[model samples]
Target: MGTATKAILTVLLAFLIFGAAYASSGLSIKSELKAVTIKYSLEGTPYIDYVGLQLPEIEDQISGISQDTTKILLSRFYATGLLYNASKANENGYFTWSGELKMRVRVGQMTTDVNVPTTINLYGEYDADGFLRSGRGNLTTCIITISLYPPYTIGLSNPINYSFDLNSQTVNLGEITQLTGIVSLFATTTALIVALTKDKDLTLISET
Candidate 1:
């Protein structure tokens, strides 16, 4: 055989081996909850509060042996409504509140930012003679959905979902001081791999 022909065949063999290695391996992912904040209005004045919680740190790996996805859910409480006059029975009140979930993702060497907004709806009823009625208030909940895509992978899109119940039973103003401790935890882990073979060098391969 000619020297050039033998050289070409050897190069092709090497690429096949490398490609097989990549095909056997796969992708990985990691995630964590960074922070949570709540804001509300009471008597025409706005109030903001931050929940005290420990955050998890994350790192990415090149090896294919890692979790495929990570998800976190952060919940906060907001004051929906307040009784202006306790003397009037059967009075109704309404208030608006909001919170947020912030996330950071690391895909290989690239990091992306994601923010999800949350809102709360609250309603309350008063009793006769302006006294606030027990079990007359209601609170609304929130949910978040996140979808992640790799750089060059095919037939693979990771989706993460979270739900939060911010009802009156779940949150309260006087008890807020006690709820300041860490209540929940979240985490995500991931790994990445880029296939590079001499035979495939002529054709550009995207990074994931």
Candidate 2:
């Protein structure tokens, strides 16, 4: 092979190696509605929902943890009943709704196995008409703040805990609240490669 050809091949080889090492352009999140259901009573029916876990931002904030960038997810807590709780066919059921917050932080290729703090707060209210309404259809209305701190050890059963300070304005949970976070596609890829590399007998060669 010619020297020029070898040089070109070397460059290609470097990129290939880098590509293998660099898996994510940003972080990513895996989320699910851990639990959700609707309850019925003579007065009214209440809805209950739960978000399993919030993910990290996959775009925008690709860099490590930053205050300017945030990774947060808001959840709504729901319930309903009338002033007089009743199960009879003629009475209406009183209902109430609330919300809780959970946070997940991602650093580099590792989604630091940390205990995320979550709290359920009253987020819904009933009107004179007996209609259930939330501050917003979803908690997306609130400006969420995300702060990534250094990785720390968390027990298998212990997770970070955070509670929302209830206010008159925060209640009613008829609908689902969106959970948002900072996840990196790049970071994910990095993690996969590291794991695979550990078990592989790797080989490298320049491309022409």
| Least well predicted 10-residue stretch by lDDT in candidate 1 | 184-193
Whole-model lDDT for model 1 versus the true structure?
0.33
Task: Point to the candidate with the largest lDDT.
Answer: 1
> Model-by-model lDDT, in order?
0.33, 0.30
Error of 1 at 124 (Å): 14
Q: Taking the tens digit of each residue's C-alpha lDDT, what string does model 1 give over 1-208?
A: 3457646766665565454443333211122222323344333344443332221211221112122211122222211223223344576656445554344445567666445453544454454433223222222333333345644232212332222222111122223322221121010001111222432443444322
Model 1: what TM-score?
0.20
TM-score of each: 0.20, 0.20
lDDT string for model 2 (126-196, tens) is 33322222222222213333345554433332222333221112122212211111133344445546644
